[model samples]
Target: MAKLFPFLQIHDFLSDKLSKEILDYAEARQADFSPSTTSSGGGMAMVTNQRISMTLKDLAEFGPAIRENILAIAPGIIEQLKISPFEIGEIELQLAAHGDGALFVTHIDTGVHEKSEKPRIISLVYYMHTQPKKFSGGHLRMHTLPIGEDDVQPVDITPDHNSLIAFPSFAPHEVLPVVAPNVAFKDWRFAVNCWIHRA
Candidate 1:
């Protein structure tokens, strides 16, 4: 866990073989990824220039291993972060791809779908991009509370392949712009975003 920010970081979160299969599955379903949307004050979801990326939700049926594994470790993750425990409700799992120049500016994760009966409690991001890093940027930057008139300090977390990071859904964060420079979809920054909801 981070000293100041509440988060859990685990390297090699998935076996290499399983990771490869998951990656292949996401690529095979490339046609399903649509522009990711942002939530407005009125809870409407709309695609805007502020967020440049693609997303495919309801991926659990096809990615059961990934979903089960995440559930297995969620309690430990929450315990480590010192978050109050609550009955876990439906988990929203999705595949997200960040192509060249893609980014989601500073934002919190709790209200993406405000109409849902269960609210988001924790946010997990698992990076599964190619090795040797085909792209630049696309790092996860967590923002600290402003310090006495100073701006919010930023803690940049590199999107290491096969690594998973977890934090509270209300934490302010952002996906830095990615530069994939003439590369194919495989070179894009790929991630599995899991949101644990409170029942």
Candidate 2:
């Protein structure tokens, strides 16, 4: 293990061929995600303008490229957790847009549902924004605290277009607010969030 809490930036992790195929499939399979607006209207509020989401099974028609990436990334993430023989139960794509300061605030993505088999051991997020660089803000921030230390350190990750980020699910993290809006801001932020489990 390189570090107990580290953020990885794997650029161009998805091949062009696969990325193109997945994009096409995502286009056809994409569905508008309901507003997950938070009570607060600043750093972490989910926009009400536009959001999209798709389940792994729904995206299966897109071909093996998507599933292949999921399969490959999940196990590798587990290896980092020092856990072996684990499985991924469910995967989801979270697409958001800048609708009046919409952004995800600081919070841990632990299992939301009661008694979820997944338990969110690890979380894998893939950036699908065509122009990830042009967009302002929306950075994924990771926070870490030593076992007994009260002070927490933060790391910022803004992987280039088509990059992927994997880390422990228990880690406290949040998506920083998008400071400015762009022409592409009308559509979803375009990122896949997957939850992992023990095999």
Report, for every candidate in turn, its global Cα lDDT versus the true structure.
0.84, 0.57
Q: What global local distance difference test value does model 2 have?
A: 0.57
Taking all chains together, the TM-score of candidate 1 against the true structure is 0.90
Worst 10 residues of 1 by lDDT: 145-154
Quantify how close model 2 is to the true structure by its C-alpha RMSD in Å. Answer: 5.9
Candidate No. with top lDDT: 1
lDDT by residue (97-139, candidate 2, tens digit) is 3332556666666653234544656677777655444456677
Candidate 1: lDDT over CA atoms? Answer: 0.84
Best by TM-score: 1
Badly placed stretches (over 4 Å) of model 1 are 1-4, 58-62, 112-116, 147-152
Count of residue pairs whose backbone atoms collide, per candidate? 0, 7
* Candidate 1 residue-wise lDDT, 53-150, digit = tens: 99988564546777788889988998998899888877778799999999999888875434566888899999998777789999999887643544
